[model samples]
Target chain A: MKANYGYMDGSGEYYITIDTDKCMECSEHFCVKACPAGLFRIIEDDYEDMVAEIIPNKRQAIKYDCAPCKPLEDRPELPCMAACTPQAIEHSW
Target chain B: MVTIGIDVGAKNAKILILKDGEILISKYRESGFDQAGVTTALLDETLAELKLTRDDITSICSTGAGRKAVTFANEVVTEVSATSRATFEMYPEVRTVIDVGAEEGRAIRCGERGKVEDFAINEKCAAGSGAFTEAMARALELTVEELGKISLDSSASVPMNAQCAVFAESEVISLLHANTAKQDIAKAIHDAIASRIVSMTRRVGLNKPIALVGGMARNVGFVHSLNAAIEDEVLIPDSPEMTAAYGAALIAAERAA
Candidate 1:
């Protein structure tokens, strides 16, 4: 299953897309540690497959929660996306 | 047998009672800190008003952000499916559905028979949802209802730059400091929210006629802005907030049958 999290607001569009097929294969759950905001969690999806998803409580504040990692100058690859070896995560800005 | 649908939304909990495929009664209350408790009491209160007993409800399907809390429910459905089912029932011609609740917003594309074709959600931020307008209203020193009413009086369009609700509140104050009209500020608030929703809807393909549901449908100011943003008049079902619950009831009815 492919799940899209985050939202588009007045300022801009911010979305985190996750491909669970790739996520389910990686047990390390590296994204959980990569994000300083603790945005990702390994949850049992509707299909009973354990996959990464944005934490529910964090859904309402994705823009601010993800900002510290994305400075205006010389921003590196997002820590969460950088750590995911399966390449299951993406950000739509 | 009657079937009941409960939607424990982010800000409101709604219950719909259906008998023989028709709505019998529906009610809603604030979700509050105790969603499960509030919903259970709401169901009991609604039943008492109708002089019906719990036994009359043979099945119950729950949906929304707090669906898992409804443990007594016979089944659970996602808000997307529930709203599409209800929208299809109301307007078969509607291929797109937009739902903006307190804390979230989503755009759903419905194919034949309301099966969800594709959908996009503005889930993580409160700015695309009713909660943004609510906070803006507070910042403008007006009630939410008053804010909606005053928005209609505006003749000017002012752009709001803030994406976060907290920052938006600060911006509203700055606009007031600049002596901007209250009505213009209110209109800007609605326009900003509508813009985000329209952008999200476009991603899923804005097939018309669009049906607008959820709590925000009742806000005429938002409705006006949304219609303008979509460039096509949107269809709003009667008592739009209950669409999700009504659809869940329909699902419960099917399961019972």
Candidate 2:
């Protein structure tokens, strides 16, 4: 289950996508702690599985919220993406 | 030397003209869908007021959300760099800057000489920015400025549970339906934003004297809430919205020199 958060605007597309299939295999959820904005939260799905999800309030504004981290010249690896050992998080920038 | 700095913010376009390190003139206008057009008009108007023209400007720099739209700018600077530079210039003792604008919030930690050491930002969430306050104010049937003043009269703590701006609006309406005092609701809104700002600032490590810039800095209620949230005094520039433009102008001055 790939959960996509954020939307596209005139500036660009920004999405914090989480692959729940990979997320369920992980024991420790580091992504929850790694996000400076506290954008990730753990929620139980209808299937009774716990997974990481982007907080609803942050879904629309990831472009601006993540601006300090995403520089134009040389985009460094994102902290949340780097923290997820399962490689479940991806940013569509 | 005369230089110009333009800040094309999400809601407003601000321009500053610096003459030999002093701010000669500053102008602000609503962006109104066309950021570049509004910015050019603002610059031209300011220059005309100063009896100058674009040719008189040694350099032109731009910053903020719509900075890329400033086609005529000689350079563009990041908001973090520009804000820190302007704050440090005004208050040399400031090591931290908390800027809450209409659409975003940023906390910057700076080293000596206003170099950005670290920073944190809350951009995607309206609940933590000035927009949240504006929405809440509209729900309460109060202007943004009126909301700020009324919040100062709040005597009791009314905690707001909603973390999302949309949810918070419904919450405010419910509070109003339940006959909760408007002053308390206003305080709750300011407190919510202040707490979010404090947490963001903590990520960068707060150091005093911390200066608050951007449009929200003018809100007395929000400033008080921030001071209480951080348990420390925070400075405010004379014209908080112009900090970014001032910093950009200063950079242009440096480049010209």
Candidate 3:
């Protein structure tokens, strides 16, 4: 039997999953480089607006969201799946 | 049996002539809006060199980044169809095919009998592509061929941020200013590009016996880093860039048969 897979034309079914805990302190964010679809981008979320960055000796940092290399139907076979060195990124089936 | 295939891509064109499971002639050329004229010229040139007429060709098929552009061809197939067909023909054991070009890159999964079962493509960016590599090489005052050779010599890893080619160029310039080693920078770029390809390939679910094709496949550094990143040996065709065209020709032959 032939197995059916892959995204239909102009539509895709893969979603990028990030283990935020693994990404919190990682430096070599290769996910930003590996997605040929231009799906991964470094967007620094402002914690000050959401919460606050200043508090004596508090380890406060903003969140970085790694998205699909491009926008498609719901999602894409995310190019970030294998790029994360810490195994922090995944693709939802 | 004779068959012809044409691949009209964003940055280039490829033509192939095959007979009885053998490639007789192949040509690669740059493509433009006037694809018909360009294809005619290339065909005439190749036919003249091979001492054959267009009538000698029994069937025609087209594929590539611009498969739909070959209006004069007998049939136009998806690059996925043609890539899987051609890759399986050359290496029947191949389960994965990675095609990287000037404009985009793709990962394909093929099953038995050379059928494409799953695939992923990146059509949006110049980053992690042949064109981006070429542009970076020019910025570094190096040729694409020399870049790979020198990149392999690096002893350290230089960090590069920026997924866009434009931003990557800025990052490269900054790295130069920061006195980062050139070889290290080169290796870093390869690593960066490898990161993207690995991500895409993983989406398609990398299995064993991966084959790489397209113009960027000619880069030894890419091959090395890609192999290292994935920890799998890569299979590249004798003429790695022409695999897509050959696949198109194979489809033409199949249809004729």
Candidate 4:
């Protein structure tokens, strides 16, 4: 299951996509520590699968929160994605 | 030349026609699923009343949530910039701005030219926005307007523990069953929203001469709650809901110039 967390408004679209299927196979929750803002958390989804999800309060402000690691001027692979060896993470902006 | 701003908000689509900073026509309608269709209809109605055509307008800027749906827009501005422009045009002294709309709440630190230096928004949570008030009003069997007015009658502070709007509705029902005063409950609802908004606003640093805009600005109860939370009365511009659209029109005019 691909879970996209974020929102779209007049400003722009900001979302963090996580593939729970790939996440389920992983024992190392590196994405949790990889996020500088501490936005990712381990949670049990409705289907009882333990998955990494964006924290409730921080989900709305990911654009600003993720800016440090994902600067537009000289962009590199996102910390969260680079930490996720399963290649389960992506960003929509 | 006439410039136009169209705001396709979550709850309403509003259009403003401006010429030399003077508003010629302003109109709004309850926004449904078809954002662009609804806005075009609203624009047509306003133009019909003003005896103007799209060609007569020098430029058009679309803003708010559904701004992209307005394909005819010459430009699209974000809500933060739109709010900043409108605030500068209306209250240049304002150094901070808090806008609470139906779906979102934002706190902006404004610069001398009404530029947004920084902003924090409550986007994913209904508890931090006007939708929470609407849910509470429905649970209390009162109109949204009536709930705001009725809350003003209560002096007692009732605490709302639920941070989610759906759970808050259950909390309201429980309070009602326990024979709690409706006005007190209303006040609690507004207070809860205010606390959430204030916390978010604090992130951007709430400066003096703060201005409040958006549809929620019209709620007197919310305003009073916000004042008590911040220990200051925020400035409310005329037609607070229209401020974003007006700001967009101003941006359109500047871009055209």
**Per-model B-chain TM-score:** 0.97, 0.98, 0.96, 0.99
Q: Taking the tens digit of each residue's C-alpha lDDT, what string does model 4 give over B15-121? A: 99999889998889998999978988998899989999888989999999999999899899999999999999999999889999999999888888778888877
What is the C-alpha lDDT profile of model 2 across B1-257, one tens digit per residue?
99888998889999998999888888898988988788877877788888897788789999999999899999899988999999889999898899999999999988888898888777766876899899998899999999999999999999787767888899999999999999999999999889778766766767777899999998988998999988888899899999999999998888779
DockQ score of the complex predicted as candidate 2? 0.08
**Regions of model 3 farther than 4 Å from truth:** A1-93
- Which 10 residues in a row give candidate 2 chain B its minimum summed lDDT? B199-208
The candidate, 2 or 4, that scores higher on lDDT is 4
B8-89 per-residue lDDT for model 3 (tens digits): 8888899999989899989888888877788888888998999988788888898876776677689789888888998998
Model 1: which residue pairs collide?
Answer: A59-B124, A60-B124
Q: How does residue B141 of candidate 1 score in lDDT?
A: 80
Candidate models: Cα lDDT each: 0.88, 0.86, 0.74, 0.88
For candidate 2, what is the interface RMSD?
7.6
Q: How do the residues B35-126 of candidate 1 rate in per-residue lDDT, one tens digit apiece?
A: 87998899899999999988878999999999988878989999999999999889998899999998889889899988988887777667
TM-score of 3: 0.76
What is the DockQ for all candidates, taken in turn?
Answer: 0.04, 0.08, 0.07, 0.05
Worst 10 residues of 4 chain B by lDDT: B198-207
How far residue B166's Cα lies from its native spot in candidate 2, in Å, is: 0.8
Query: Measured with DockQ on alpha carbons, how good is candidate 3?
Result: 0.07
* Per-residue lDDT of B7 in model 2: 91
User: Which residue pairs collide in model 2, if any?
Assistant: A61-B124
Residue B9 error, candidate 1, Å: 0.8
Task: Kindly list the per-residue Cα lDDT of model 4 for residues A24-71, writing each as its tens digit.
Answer: 788799999998889999999899888899998777667656756653
